[model samples]
Target: MDEFTSEELLEQLQQLDEQPRIEAKRASEIGKSVMQTICAFANEPGLGGGYLLLGIDEPSSVHESFTVCGVTDADTLLNTLQGNCREQFESPICVKGQVELLDGKKVIRLFVPELAPSAKPCTFKGKFDSKNKRKTGIWRRGLNGDYECSQQELEPLLLAKSGTSYEQIQLADAHWDDLDLSVIALYRTLRSKVRPYAEELQASDAEMLYALNLVRKQQDEWVPNVAGLLLMGKPLALRRLLPSVRVDYVRINGTKWVEDPEHRFATTLDLREPLLRLIPKLEATITDDLPRHFRLKEGDTQRSDEPLLPHKVIREAVVNAVMHRDYQVNQPILVVRYSNRIEIRNAGYSLKPEATLGDMGSKLRNPLIASVLYDLNFAETKGSGIRTMRRLLKQSGLAAPVFVSKVIENEFVATYLLHQLLGEEQLNWLTQFSHLHLTDDEAKALLLTREIGAIDNAGLRAITGLDTLSASQVLGRLHHQYHLIEQGGASSATYYQLAPQLQNDDQLPLFSGEAEASSEPNTSDLGTDTSDLGTDTSDLGTDTSDLNPATDTDLPEKLSQKIEQLTPKARRDKLWPVIVWLCALRPYKAEELATQLSRKETHLKHSHLNVLREQEKLIDYLYPEVINHPSQAYKTTDKGTNWLKHQGIEIE
Candidate 1:
């Protein structure tokens, strides 16, 4: 009576290699790992818990396929699993299990529902080791698998259980002087514009901040909380206290991220001003760099100049980034301006599910920040930002912004393309595929995938105005019938990218005349036949060096020895440095790193790679523009190298 059957779960596992909600194991008896997964399922917030399929062996390295090894004692195994769930934890977890047959082999399908928030941070019944200061028994789901929670990692969970947001916590070290008085005055001015007779405007600075819940009294003195400092903190205070609480505006010279460090960015500006000043500054920075156009209205005497991107759209995007960002994460909000698009990457993922982003309800991660922004007319309280951005972009003849929210990675990226979605140039490109007789929506999906390097159901719906089901159907047709695209991920996480043939074909010039007129060097210019480009190999010299050196063979003796000394149950703090060292050598795909480290790919991604890249800024993506690129990999940045050197590790 589960929403998904064992067959469906198995198919997803086989296709995706792993899924957040599905775990398969050949269980002869209830074990530690099984209990840990159960604990993770029960405690992981927003996961809604997960499924455990017993008697199914995981895919092996050699075969890369899952095998159904039937369980001999399903009843006893089920009893033990249920018993452990009831008796082992701080609060009893009620898990449901049923025996199911798959591939003519018996398996136990158990669904563990997440516990209520108040009952969470579910630790095993054990003695507290105060001297060690370690969180021994609490478990949470990670990209690789269930891992014990570290003290630092448990803070958010503990806060959630107490119904206290990180933003509301009063900073003991922050005094009234930390908040900028000029910024508070600016807030008053903006508030008066929204409501001239607003009650808050009549109060003093301290009273106003208290009214906004920005400050709390401690030892009979008003102290700035996180929201207060974020909204009106002096630049020096912000730098000294919340160093990562700022915006990094980077201008890339071209459409893609350049790999060369010397020429990586054309301009870089870091702003640590208060949110009131920072939001407008960010918008102005982006607008000033954008290309402008002239538009003449009906009965207009003269044409009016306007930025290519609508001002309102830019405002909303900027406001949304700062308003709901997770302050606990020590990373700056990154705004990158490329030749063709603008990307805003923030520390926090959307509190709302990705599927429900444009829906009419708001889910605020930082309610205090959101409330302040709302009062000043900077943001809408009803979650109308996405909807407004889509409408404005559509009216302006621009593509709808694409949003990618990674919950496990704790990151959200909003990408706005500078050009029209299906302009004349794209139409000309579509002419080559006219023989396929694609529908208008299908064509849009294809063009979007090509432009962005990948497309998902949500992204397709955004561009083509299709419902979820219709968009999914169109993607399926492209993936299955036409074979123009291939699938990755599974279920709601599924995405489609152009097939290898189409990807290659799209890169080549469509017409012979165009190919001949191309300025770039070609085989024909080298006195070689154009037809020999694909087949000729004898003249191509071989370079034996590794293109991606994130392998066991490439690991340095120091790092290899360090890794060997670590146990399977080592803390993440101990594991992260090693991961950084391995990636420091060369770019490594998540799978490659997992293989080298003997961990699950998803676990490595969620627990280590993402933390390193997003929060720490020690590592970066090889193909940042296309996050789900086929050959996406991670590389250590200059910051990572410096961090290693600071730790007394020599780098080549």
Candidate 2:
């Protein structure tokens, strides 16, 4: 069974979206109902295995969310499932179950292993023809629910049980002539580059092809096999033999595939070539379509324009798509290129479990094709593909590649986000906390929380490539020392979300009215709504509290020194409490803040003021619905005042 954190499990349930290897049950008791799902999971043909979670209630109302109600009697359910597995089938099913608390409620999750071929077609009462509303023993999991497998679906499993790999099957209709000689020559050239001393380079055509398992002597004639047809077969041969063998490269203009019927893709390049030839072409096509960035290298006066995405990474992805895609599937590999990311969807579920995706060990569906590509220097061996992508993207300051492998969909999609992860904008934002000297791990934790709303120690490990201990340590330091994020959950299920202060800042609008008046989005506007700044500060609610907090005598030593070091824009963070505290006393207009702070109305109103109100939820609007009201004024809430006092900011 694969390892997944409870946080991840909860997240999946909350979304109420079905996962190929995940199922949820909200029942208080375990019976044949739960057993049916287990049978389906174990006998799920090609899907590796699946998990069953009990105690999470599905959404009962449109407005309500999926909630973790937890099992009422966990011990009874666990014992029931264990006893049934022991007594029900011809061979005992191997299932592992445990009780874990979700949102503090005890829930039972079961991991059902895919039964071995010999033990499959897991039936009730040791037979398929059970009459207790269970018509057949052979069951399959589908989009709706588990159902009895029909003859068509059950037939494939019988064939797969014979221990024959798909790629090794001989295509009786295909002859040696179907193989492309040019591709064979290219393979030899690449092999020589990799292993110059190899004697195979000097071998005859038929001998080399035979050695590569491209053509084998079948009875009296040399015939091409599935491997041969895939690695270097002629275009027409593939078109006729494997009609869906092609790559669809689509260029979308926005972040997502356009759903609007009227919108068309920027460009679409469809290539149907032999695997060896298609890879390089596919790599180049995607790279050419990508936007480039300029970087200054050593001894360079001018910036160099290189593809934003690494070419090597692109090659690995395209190669894997062709090499691992299920040719049995009558679907083209769709490479959707949006402006910000590239998505490569192949019609195959990873043979290896999702937990071991990046492990060096591999489970190849087509070893012969893999070997041919290896000799041709097209793709990496084992599972180095994902590791290489991670290393390269990290070096370029981009996100780690994301893999979505679903056995139910029988497809795998790899997403490569083209933008730099923590580029100039994020870097500038982090500088406000430069005083902490945050490590990459800590910074990443904060960034992820900002992006995903929350992150767990397990997710931190996934992103940082760190062990459990290291990830936890980084999370701990951030939570305890810097107090940047707040810890939630307990023990191994622990996760973290951004502290309220940061959450508040994150909620602020990207632009104030005055800031948007400019052509470009400016980060410099660090304070108020400059467009609404009035004449002066005299109308500052007649509150002396603002002047009192601003006085040198009232300021604390540590904070005072930091304020002096920060620029006017940076100072807004520490001084926001003061601003909000003053606003709590009485309603004040934007111009009043400018006068009290002795700062530019444009800077104060455009940058800090709106962020303090919107994100922090500290201040309220005089005309909340009418944001641009002429007489709009601001006042702080009790939550804002309490937060200030909690942070040790005080009124003298």
The top-ranked prediction according to lDDT is 1
Candidate 2: tens digits of C-alpha lDDT, residues 498-595: 78888777432211221223232121321222221132112111222332223544445654464456455556566786677667655677777676
Please give the distance, in angstroms, between residue 54's alpha carbon in candidate 2 and its true position after superposition: 6.9
Worst 10 residues of 1 by lDDT: 535-544
Give residue 231's error in model 1 in angstroms.
Answer: 0.4
Q: Candidate 1: lDDT of 356?
A: 79
TM match of model 2 to true structure: 0.58
Q: Give candidate 1 regions above 4 Å deviation.
A: 15-18, 61-67, 127-135, 259-262, 437-442, 455-652
Model 1 C-alpha lDDT per residue in residues 455-515, reported as the tens digit of each score: 8766776566665556777887888899988998544456788889777764412223122
Q: How accurate is candidate 2 locally (lDDT)?
A: 0.68
Question: Which candidate tops TM-score?
Answer: 1
**Global lDDT of model 1:** 0.77
TM-score of each: 0.80, 0.58
